[model samples]
Target chain A: MAVTLKEVAERAGVSRSAVSRTYTDGASVSPKTRKKVEKAAKELGYSPNALASSLTTGRTKLIGLISNNFHNPLFLEVFDLFTRRLQEKGLRPLLVNLTDETDPENSLRMLKQYSVDGVIVASSTLSPEFAKAFHDAKIPVVHSFGRFASAPDVHVVGVDNVECGRMAARTLLARGYKHIGFLGGPKGATSTIDRRAGFMEVMGQAKGIKVKESNAAAYSFEAGRTAMLKELKGTHAEAYFCGDDVMSIGALSAINSSGLSAPTDIGIIGLNDMEMAKWENIDLTTIRQPIKQIVDSSVELVMAALEDSNRHPEARLFSCQVIERGTLRPL
Target chain B: MAVTLKEVAERAGVSRSAVSRTYTDGASVSPKTRKKVEKAAKELGYSPNALASSLTTGRTKLIGLISNNFHNPLFLEVFDLFTRRLQEKGLRPLLVNLTDETDPENSLRMLKQYSVDGVIVASSTLSPEFAKAFHDAKIPVVHSFGRFASAPDVHVVGVDNVECGRMAARTLLARGYKHIGFLGGPKGATSTIDRRAGFMEVMGQAKGIKVKESNAAAYSFEAGRTAMLKELKGTHAEAYFCGDDVMSIGALSAINSSGLSAPTDIGIIGLNDMEMAKWENIDLTTIRQPIKQIVDSSVELVMAALEDSNRHPEARLFSCQVIERGTLRPL
Candidate 1:
């Protein structure tokens, strides 16, 4: 049987209330009683039950980490960073994988059932409605790697996809590629739409620079390869800014399979600059989104919300820069 | 204000117990009352509180999914499968990232505080002590991708690493590779030790087959690359059986960087035919560990343990087979 708080209190020669206060954060208790309670608890191998204590404090310290794109390897980094940072702050991450989920109701129900103190919707493809649903439920939520909006109803932390698209376009133009294309992620994704907007806006300014935009079914290597293969069969661009690193790697594979090579037959740039992009074999030139910073800030925001649910929603945008490698041609 | 169960009961024109029974799984409730309760719940946007019910049922429905290696791309697939399967069973996944964690006590304390129904230690590199700690704490646990023994102290679901190593050796020998090597992960890892043992056992039987063994710091691309670079500086083997796919890919990169190529200068094979192994760019010949099966079985085992804490600890070993790809020379 698990050791109880009563046993620790009795062993420490202190009141049950003192034992509870010692375990409760910011709860006042005499130092002598606290030291005795701690020693007794340690000896009895007793861990304060978060559930039992939550009934009193109204805080579970459980954060719902919701995501949809598990197939993408980039999320591995995101998950790692989020979990580590949350763990450091003594907050537990309850991961909710929304792989086939289209309705946000299911996720909202699950989070509510789990009694999560807050939630971090870590996905770019998921519609803003998903985040708004959590807000409507009055749950503290922060969207990580979410689309940038002039006015966000919920906490938003990520890079500007539009600016990333503009950077990709400018990088391709400087490389002297008159014909360029935007191979993006899912067509309906806000990130893809915003990126395409920025890319087209820049290309339209430069006369004689014809740009075509297309999208992969998903942000995966297979989808990227298939989309690039289809593009190769038709009018191919001299340079292409693939949606993300995974897609860029896929595009490179498709080009190689067709007896064509990057930077010679075609130039490519990617976003996110995932760890795999830096592999000597891949060496992809891409836009580096500050993934670590975004994750840290998101965790911080969620913690702040936990402390004050009335905390006003804020949008924290991190700047992304070009990371030159081997995928794109030299300017 | 959030809608209360009391309000839902009053609106449904049914007793509070009747309304509670309607929401409770397997609880007895009349059809007419159930319909009325459901209607009232929908109208009030009332979702059952899992925590409040958990206090009565003594089941939190939260399973701690623990992992140490987020750097390995293979984990993306593992996490995806585990989370999907857990959610399908109406269980919540509390992800415990032990990337930098060395002490099992910390994890045990955290899981205890969370009051998780069970835990799934999904790692090959983490020591047996990690899973044993959970078991000792009276928590139901299934170690997925863990080392299997005839008499396991804790429930284990994974492939036999030793047999996999023997298969790799036989494969390399059949392909007429005289000098072979074992490029494994960390020396302290159970997978690495077991795989090396099997590889040496098979190599011992074959005459005129020279074998050397080395290990990477960890099962990461950078570690593998660094290990292989050191090997290339000296007399390397004609072929190598890497610890895993990521390591194999790293070795391939190192060989290419040194102006050497696989199947010509050297051949390579790896274990865990992860999604990336099939990428046209990597195309690694590897041993498929049946990750989906292991993850599914792990979830099943943990769920069963939750139902019956007295369930006997058993080892569920799955078969691994060689996935022929472009890494190895055609026989």
Candidate 2:
């Protein structure tokens, strides 16, 4: 049987309430009584139950961290940063996978059942509707790597995808790539749509530059490869701005297999400079999303919401910059 | 204020106990009362609080999913499969990152405080002492991807690292590579030690089969690249069996940068045919550690342990197979 507070109290020659107070943070207890309780607890190897204590304070300090795209390597960094940051602030992360979930109600129900202090939805593909649903149910929510709107309905944190798209167009044009293509992620995703719009906006005004566009089924390597392979079999552009690094890597593979060299024959640029993008064999020129800043701000916003449920929702957008690597040709 | 059982009881015109019985699984309740409670709950959008109900059932249905390595791409697939499987069985994953942790006592105390139903340590490099610590504290735990002892102190589920090492050595020999090498992970890691032991045993019995051994600082790509770069600066073996796929990719990059090619200048075979290993760009010939089966079995074992805390610890070992790819020479 596990050691209880009552047993520790008896061993310490103090009241059970005194033992509880000693373990509780911010609870008043005499220094001598705390010393006695600590010694007894150490001897008994006793750990105060967070669950039992939560019942008294009505605060479990559990934060539901929901994500759908574990396929992207970028999320591994996000998970590492998130778990460490949450734990640093004395909160436990209850990870929820939404890969197969389409209905926001199911996630709302799940988080509600757990009585989470707040939630942080970490996904670019999952609609902002999911985050708004949680907020509607009176749960403090922060959406990280989510699309930013002029007037966000929920607390959103991520890069400005449309501006990144414009930046990609400007970079390729400045390099004197006359014919360009936009190889984007799935058509229905908000990021894909916004990026396509911004790319079209810049290309439309340039009379001499010709632009073409298509999309992969998903943001995965295989999908990008399959889409690019089909393009290679037809009329392909001289330069392309792929959706993300993984897709850019896949497109590079297709080009290499087709006996074409990067930058020399067909230049490429991607977004989200994930860890693999820096690998020597797959060095990619891409936009850095500033993941650490976004995640840190998301955590702070969620904590603030937990304190004041009525806190107004805010949009936290980080700037993206082009990271120079091997894939893009010199200006 | 959150809706309570009392509100549901009042709306349904039934006793509070009746409303609880209607919500509880396998609890006895009249069909009329159940219908009434369901209507009232749906109208209020009330979810039976899992934490509050856990107090009475003595089951939080929370499993502590612990890991230390998030940089490896293989973990993305692992996390996807683990979280989806756990959720399907009505268990929530409380993700605990032990990246900076060296002491098992801290982890033990943290999990104990949460009153989690079980814990799963998902790392091959972590010491067996960590798993045993949870077992000693009378918590149900399954060490996924952990080294298997002949007589396990705790439930272990993964491939036999030693056998995989032997298999790698034999594969290299069959390919007619007379000069072989073992490039293993950190020296002190149980997996690395076991792999090295088996590789040496196999090489020792083979006549005229020269073998060299070196250790990488970690299971990551950089460590493998650094170890191989140092070897490339001098005389190196004709073929090497890398401890894992990420290391093999690193080694391949090192060879490429040195103006050499895999399977031509130096053959390399790695373990754990992670998704990246199958990519056209990487195309690494490695031993496929059945991660899916190992993960499924680990979940089943942990669930069984939760049902019966006294369940004896057992080792579940899956077989590893050589996956033919571009990295190794043809037989």
Candidate 3:
């Protein structure tokens, strides 16, 4: 059985209020009384209940970490960074997996029931409406890796997908590829939409350049491989710019299975320089998304929001850069 | 502002007890009063606080999921299955990252403060003493992927690493490998010790067979690759049984960097046929650990412990088998 505060008070021969004051932060209590209470508590193995004390402090220090993509290997890095950083700040993460969930009502209900001090939606595929739900309910929220907006309804921290798309297009053009393809993730996803728009914007302006575009069912390996297999059946493009690194790996596998290889028969470039992209056998040349900076900025924004709920929602965008590897031909 | 039960009751023209009963499971409330309370709560956007109600129910429905290895990709699959399964049971997972932590007292104190109903230590590197700490403090715990004991002090759910090692030795011998090597994880980890013991037990009895053994600093890719790079400087064995798949992938990368390949220049087999092992580029033949079954059984055991805290601890060992792919030479 857990040791109760009352038992510690009895053991210390002090009133319950004195024992409470001894534990509460910055609460006034004489050093002698504190030493006595501390000795008794240690002897009794008594730890104050955070939930009971939360009733008075009105702060639970719990953050709801909401995400939808578990299949993507990139999320492993994201979770590791988020959990470790939150733990350092003395905040516990209540993980909520919304893999197949579309509605926000169930998650909101659960978050409120737990009385989470704030929420962080760490997904690029989830719509802006999802994070807005928490804000509408007066819950402090920050959306990490969310779509970039000039004036976001909630605090947003991530890269500009449209600019990333433009960068991918310019890189391919510089490599002297006449015909290229865009193998993107889900068509309706904001990341895919913005990336496609920017790719088309640049490709359309370039003289005598032909571009074909297709999308995978989801941002997963099987989906990317399946989509690439269908593309390879016909006369495919010389090289392609894949949606993300995981999809690029999948496409590389499909090429290998079809008795072809990268940069020799088909060149590919991907975004999101996840850990897997750096492996020797899977040497994928890709654009790097600064995940650590994004996560840290999101946490800081949420902490600021908790201090002042009326703080205006701000958008923070980090720049993306090309990480040169062997998947694409040398420039 | 959060809508209180008193405001909800006043709006519904009912008593505070009626509003509380309407939300509490199995509580007494008339249908008319329940309808009125629901309408008022919906109008006021009120959700009952689980933490506050936990005082009366004495159940938080929160389970602490503790882990240490975040660099391993296999953990992505493990966390995905665990969070989804726990959510299905209406239990929320409070993720605790113990990446660099050694002492269990800190975790025990934090877990006690939140009053989590139970804990599941899902790590092979963590010692049995870690889980026993929770058991000694009267907190129900189940150690998934933990080392097995004949009469375990806490509920244990995982595969038998020793049998897996023996199976690896037999499989390599069947392939007519005369010189074999054992590349194990950290020396002090229970899983590593047990697996090495079993592998040695089988190899020691074979005649005219040479076995060389070494251990990596960690199970991560960098450690595996660095260890293998050093091993390649000498006359390495024809085949190696790596501790796990991540290490196997690392070893493969190392082999490639040293201008070698698998099944031709060198052969390798690994444990935990993780998702990446099946990719066409990395068709690693490995022993499958039945991760989904292990996770399901661990959740069930913890739920049972929740119902009866005094229940006797049991060990559930699942068998593992080799999943043939392209890494090992055909037998």
Candidate 4:
């Protein structure tokens, strides 16, 4: 039903190989022949079939952009950056929502079936095992927002969550919050474990400072609210450094409902500094994770891997900065 | 190198056709033959490639899930639903981000290049012409969260924005907001036009009630806040029916920053009761747009269109319901 390359070549009076070379990246073709082919292609409104050409080139140009936490507002930024970056490089994102998907074999098989050139598993909550599985299957995979690994098994791009944890703890302690709480995402996620580790590491040394810890079932608004509500049921800390902004917002809501105001009754701090954190209604004090840098680096690494799949796996970590807002008392 | 189907077939002691049929949906194959094929496939780590079969079947099972609004939190829910629903049907979502993309030809050519089975235009802000262009190109297209049309150029699955506007107006008036305003999304968007028309239609008849209109640049937090801040610079109405929740949240932020409270100072209502609207912190009073149903219906329509490309375009409109929360002044 659609115009074929053969027809375009015939109309252009050029060889079929000339037409193919005209559209193929880095393929050599005479300028005169390219002009003729382009005119004919435009006249016939023919687009080079990427899937058909992928069979010959053995490259689909499809990146399986896998993510599990679609509910997080931060994903709005993450996906936007990832897609735009991927597209700028002439690559398309095949969004794989592994939300509630545990088995890596099925997802690996599915992505392989689609013949995606590479996979970018972009989630902190999702286990590193998924990345390892894809890598073992011989698919080029980059884990964005993945936990920092000393001896990395896969290409990882994200902030040093442990350092961000320490930053949050210091930000609270400096503000004179004697009793602090670490309200984190799911206890199972490496992000939660690392952040908790850093928070405990800092608080463990502070003299006369008491610390408490609680975790949400998932990195969701409802989960954060439920965990905070449970904590508020008995004794609550003077300040709580929520793992991320969404959870911090949830904790703020619980505090609001409890007839108390932030920075006065119970100070709050969050990480990620998502767009919502800046909303006037929820002016949350938070830490800024360089999402753009992480996504950009991830894309660059994947492109490099596409060229050299045997590239050594490395961890690309960024630093976090505290974004003070109305959630905390002035130091 | 990936394992080929021939290798699996040879190992299973079955014809290649039998192996292909075992993987193909609704294909005839004996249970014993299927068992042998499955075992060989497992042992050889062979997965049927969608692109390879698409050459013969002419179906890629790849749906182009196109969206332009990645900044809005509401899209988190929309994307989650669309990806999950598409996956449930054994179809993969080829996510196309049209952010900053205005030319339909480029996107059309790209989707065609990938040989997607169908396209779902999932943005109300994007022009209906995009959907129409894809349809003209003979691609099955369904526009979700799009404008309603008695004679739609393409299949549209969303709510009646006109009715939703009237609901907001009536809700605000019932609460005794004598002077109301319409803080809509981009003026060019069909949602903004229909919503404003409905609001004006009801307000035009209300005796002794004054009404005004304003528009945000986009349905985003910053845009809404900026538009509302501009609105507050002059003589503003007693209440506003913001076109969507993100904009309403922006308006709420502006109102709060001005030291005015909702209901007492000004009443505000929003559409698309997104997850953030229900957050304990935001607790926005909004009209539910039933995003899940719209997405589900849109996927079903696209799948049906794949089966029968000649299917006539239809408009599937869902009713909106106002969710009572802390944003608005109670009657």
Error of 2 at B14 (Å): 1.1
Give the TM-score (vs. native) of candidate 2.
0.98
Model 3 pairs in collision: none
The DockQ-based CAPRI class assigned to model 1 is high
Residue A290, candidate 2: C-alpha displacement in angstroms: 0.6
Q: Sorted by TM-score, highest first, which candidate order results?
A: 2, 3, 1, 4
* lDDT of model 4 at position B319: 88
How well is each residue in B1-331 modelled by candidate 4, as lDDT tens digits?
7888899999999999999999877999999999999999999889988898887788999999999999998898899999999999989999888998999988899999999999999999888998999999999999998999999999999999999988998999898888888988999999899988888899898999988888999999899999888988999998899979999888889988998878678888889998888887678898998888999999999999999999999999998898999878887
TM-score of chain A of 4: 0.98
lDDT of 1: 0.92
Please give the distance, in angstroms, between residue B133's alpha carbon in candidate 4 and its true position after superposition. 1.1
Candidate 4 residue pairs that clash: none
lDDT of 3 by residue, B1-331 (tens): 6888999999999999999999877999989999999999999989998998887788999999999988899998999999999999999999999997899998889999999999999999999999999999999999999999999999999999999999999999999999999999999899999999899999998988999999998888888898888889998999999989999999999998899999898999999999989988899999999999999999999999999999999999999999998888999
Root-mean-square deviation per candidate: 1.4, 1.1, 1.2, 1.5
Q: Model 1, stretches more than 4 Å misplaced?
A: none
The alpha-carbon deviation from the true structure for residue B188 of candidate 1, after best TM-score superposition, in angstroms, is 0.5
TM-score of every model versus the real structure: 0.98, 0.98, 0.98, 0.97
The segments of candidate 4 whose C-alpha lies over 4 angstroms from its true place after superposition are: B26-33
